[model samples]
Target chain A: MNTQAVKVIYKYEMLRAWNTILQSFASPVISTILYFVVFGSAIGSRIESVEGISYGAFIVPGLIMLALLTQSVSNASFGIYFPRFTGTMYETLSAPISFIEIVLGYVGAAATKSFIIGLIILVTAGFFVELKIAHPIWMLSFLILTCISFSLLGFIIGLWAESFEQLQLIPLLVITPLVFLGGSFYTIDMLPPAWQTVSLFNPVVYLVSGFRWSFYEVSDVSVELSLLMVLLFSVICLSIVWWMFKTGYRLKR
Target chain B: MSSIISVSNLSKVYDGGFRALNDISLDIKSGEILALLGPNGAGKTTLISVICGIVNASAGSVTVDGYDIVKDYRITRSMIGLVPQELTLSMFVSVWDTICFSRGLFGKKPNPLYLEQLLKDLSLWDKKDNDILTLSGGMKRRVLIAKALSHEPSILFLDEPTAGVDVELRKDMWVLVEKLRQTGVTIILTTHYIEEAEEIADRVGVINEGELIVVDDKEALKHKLGKRQMMIELEQTIESIPESLWTWSLELSGNGSRLTYTYDSYSEHTGIAELLRAVDKSGLLLKDVNTSQSSLEDIFIGLVKVNNEGSA
Candidate 1:
């Protein structure tokens, strides 16, 4: 398994996050606080509640998921893209480590980073609204799954990206919009029935719905369906990553 | 000595139909220093990259210590350390961190004692804490070497290691290579600097147009194609070659004041005496005579030229 190889890569990646303390750790904390202020105080003062949960409390899971989605993608993508861009990836490629080890190192580190950010956002959420959990285990399960799967997606994006512009393309053009329209800030039931049907197409809906259900036991979709969707998405991302390594796409020539 | 690395019928056709390596077959001995000399854009780097597992060969196979490069990659790759031609280091990572990562990357147990000494040997000990971005180009090159050696592999590939290095540092690198050779580490290097090969290589391989045209012991390669030039200084300039000396095929240079006769130095009969006699008899009074030995560069150029002409 080349565990030491994985460890060193993991530690180095973790160290990089620690080194960029403001960007890695502080950004999510500040964003969580701001999202609370703007969406919680500004908007929540009017809406009061959604689906019987306080507006401030209702958006907490969505906020964490939003940060999780973006951070996981960006962290894993940049973690890999930096090495490829700087040509340092040659060392990793030539090393005795296998593709699995490389993924474990890069993706694992990125997931860990997002996991920490998710935790930070959760803690920040605690200060603003009373936090409650119907299923802490499921909440954690959903969070961990999202981290791993999105990090895998991010790893793919990193490998697939050719330039810095390409790196930003998927996150901005694809993920951000998906997260926004995925019912992170509002319930899809509140939308026109047509828009609600359209929202089902966005994969982020399942992630947000599943995560929100874990917290408040209120979800747009069934818990089992949400879990299956997350698992299904992870499997798809996993298969893509496996194919990338096997075919030597972007990582080898 | 057993071959530490064996590449058989290796061919690489890059994505856009560029042939990087064409049927390269070679065996690197256990502890000998081999220098691959080629012009720019030649397959030297590509070949090294393939054996080191950075690039996948389109056809054929390679084995390091009897393990296939692709099938049993871990075993084969663990046996190799590659310092690529480019400055492939992280700008933000400290020198110490870089080596530590590489050491672990190759699955070597962390040995601070060994790493510390390695940094000291490369004169990078003081800069261990400094980011690679802060170091000079030469220091970065040294860091690359240190990173390659971090795992203590039996085979090391230094792809143009001394490129852009100063003369003094180049000498130091040569000394370091010799010292490494003493430790029984087999070294393969690719360089445009023929003298670097001449100075240290036990064997030299010349690659041209994605083909390994020749690989032989240093002395043997020199003995086979190493031409010697005899410059005969005439007392006065002449308008044309004397018909009597035309049979010798001497080159008239230095405004006809000198004549150059190229001959195989290793041949029992170099024909040097005959050419000189012919020159004297042709009314060219020799003021002085000087002989120059052709360097490996000349042989390399000759090989490439011949290969190019063959392709053309």
Candidate 2:
């Protein structure tokens, strides 16, 4: 399995995270604080609760999901893309490792980084609101699944991206908007019947809804569907990655 | 010295239909230093890139130590190390970390002692902890070499290893190549510098326009195509070639004071004896006589010119 090769790539990426330790852990933590102050303290006072859960507490899972999604995409994409950009990916491609090892190394490190950020944001959100957990196991499970799935997606984007601008395009124009409109800040129940039906098409609605359910047991969609969504997303991303390596697309040209 | 890497009927056609390699076939003997000499865009880099598994071959097969480059790539690639022409490196990574990381990528256990000695060999031991960005161009070049050798592969492909570095590095690199050769590492290098090949290559291959024009032992190539020249000086200036000397096909040069004869020195009858006799009989008194052999560069230019003219 070339486990040593995987370890090398994983550690190399993790070191980059450690090197930029300030930016890696601090940005999301600070962003989480601002969101709590603005949304939890300032805005939640006007709205007492969301479906029997405090308004501040309701947004906590969504906040973590938002950061997890963005962080996973950006970290994984940059990890692979920067090597390609600098033309150093030759070492990786020329190495004895298989594509699976390459993915395991790069995607695993990125997911680990995002997973840590998700935890930090969760802990930060604790000080702002009285957090409740209906299923702690499920919460951790969902967090890990989301991190892996989104990081896989980011790996695909990294291979697909040709420029730095294209690197940011998917995470910004596609991922961020989906996270926002997928019920990160609010409930789908509040929307009109037609818009609520349309929100089902957004895959992230499944992610946020299922994550929120693990916390408060109040979800717009079933938890099984959310787990299925994460699995499905990961499978699709894996297939694309497989085809990329097989065809030598963008990588071996 | 059996074949370690065998490429047969290989071809590479890019997406836009540009043929980078044209049915190129080569067999690199194990533990020998083979140098590929070619002009720009002459498929030397493309050929190395394909064998290194960085570029996909359109057709044909390459076997490394009896393993297919595609099916058994893990095994084949692990045995091969490529130092690309470009300075492909991460600016932020330390030299020590870079070499170790590259070694690990090949699934090799960490050998700090080996890496330390390697860095010392490349004169990079003192700067091992420094970031690549802070090093000079020559130092970075050394780091690239250290990284490629970190895995301790059996075969090393150095594509234009000394393109821009100073003369001192060039000399050091050749010494290193010679040392590596002694350790039984099969080295294949692509270079524009024909003299570099002539200096170090046990075998030399010339590629032009995606074709392997010629490949032979270094000395044999020079002997095969290299022309020998004889400069004959006369005691008296002559207005023209004497009628008697016309049979020798001598060229009048040095403002008619001298005659030059070009011939294949390897031939049984070089006509040197006959030409001198003709010159003596023609009363063009020879003050001095000298002979010079054409270098590998001259032979390379001659081959490429012929290939180009043939294709045109």
Candidate 3:
């Protein structure tokens, strides 16, 4: 209901993103481009196809999802963490704004930044590999939902992390490995039967698989299951955030 | 005058059983400056935080304009603006955007003219487009004051506002504070400097060991608790005080070369004339005489010492 408050917080965050344009936007675009060169040109020459689609085109959705997940988590986490670190959070906490409004402001801005990066990476991916959206609506929905869910997760991490090491811990040791092992660059079908079963446990698999289905109607898991998993993860993150605010965990003392 | 904020029987115990506040009760009258004076760890900041709704009370309650702080947090919070002790700011943010954002966060409509006036009032208009990192420490403190006032809250809490600033800036801050009072905003400031309280506060509250030991009109507190001392230097050194002068409750120092008489200043007759006449009659030759009154600092130290000894 406090749209003005949300707008102010969101604008301030977005301005910070623009201030660090290279780190926020350019770095991801360039990294995705490099991934195309190394994966599409170097490795694609050895393996021409993944399933029926060309290997170069096959990883496009996964790469975008990878970037989306990382950027959403890091951006949102840093957004909240920096405020706390500098003690400027008192300004927002003492304001007349509600917790929901605060969340909407911070999380909304993080998702928008990640969403933009995801779309840009998708376009950059198109330059190296021929791309198609089998279900454009589903692809956009999946992209947006992934951004929101991951940003919420990042918001929780921002609250829970007590130090800089802990902030980077989940993203580096946990999230990156899950994304790479979740079949971002290769299909789980290429893995042996036992390995594929192990890969199914990784949550990033559901996100990438669901997004890939939107792109080429091919995925490691069924489209319905992927959507359900994303929805469930979103619900869980929301509940945790709601509880944090209600209990004044980290945000208040 | 009606009280704008009331805190009753408030107490706060941190997670580790550290009792930061103990049954504090205070009322802040509208449009008056109330200064809370305490030593380090006396719970001055904690008291301000509770009334501002930044910290939750373990027991009891606080109300702003009769609205409960916890149940009606939004309404009560909207009425208060806090200038915290820390210099916390987003360094990359421009001064203009910072104030504007703070105003919007309070759900206020855009008022560029008012904001312009605020900037001008704080002498920050020239630096409006500059990043906060480029500003000096004093300027940053001014920006904080500006941000707190951006929403035009009726109640302002300034915690150690002049802690590290120079005397010139401290004077300017008080001038600005007086200007704000003219607009009918209630101000509550906390300081360890008794002079700061003496300079600006209409009423002074001395808190020691998490308990408000005294709250009274500044002048009245001094008048009631203050002591006057009269020192007389003897023409010759004497080993001990004469038995006749002992009736005056005198203290002999400087190897009996000086005598000090302590008395209540508020009493109609200080009995100083009698003491002098008695000294003369006792053949105590006086070389020089001087009188001095105890300051707020002395009274504060005395009160804290008493409180510590009582609890010990």
- Top-scoring candidate (DockQ): 2
For all candidates, the clash counts are: 0, 0, 0
B174-233, model 1: which lDDT tens digit per residue?
A: 998999999999999999899999999999999988899999999999999898889889
Among all windows of ten consecutive residues in candidate 1 chain B, which has the lowest summed lDDT? B276-285
Model 2 misplaced regions, further than 4 Å: none
- Candidate order by DockQ, highest to lowest? 2, 1, 3
lDDT of each: 0.92, 0.93, 0.91
Question: lDDT ranking from best to worst?
Answer: 2, 1, 3
lDDT of 3 by residue, A83-163 (tens): 888998888878877778988999999999999999999888888988999999999999999999999999999988889
Q: What share of the true interface contacts does candidate 2 keep?
A: 0.94
Model 1, span A61-124: residue lDDT tens: 9999999999999999999999999999898889888778989999999999999999989988
Candidate 3 lDDT by residue in tens digits, B1-312? 998999899999988899889999988899999998889999999988887767778998999999998888889988999999989998988999999998998888889999999999999999999999999999999999999999999999999999999999999989998999999999999987888888988999999888999998888989989899999999998888888878889998988899999999889998999999999998989899999989888888999999999999
- Provide per-model DockQ scores: 0.86, 0.92, 0.77
What fraction of the reference interface contacts is present in each model, in order?
0.88, 0.94, 0.82
Looking at candidate 3 chain B, the ten consecutive residues that score lowest on lDDT are: B48-57
Q: What is the model-wide C-alpha lDDT for candidate 1? A: 0.92
- Residue-level error in angstroms, candidate 1, position B148: 0.2
Chain A alone, TM-score for each of the models?
Answer: 0.98, 0.98, 0.97
lDDT (10s digit) by residue, model 2, range B82-165: 898999999998999999999999999999999999999999999999999999998888898999999999999999999999
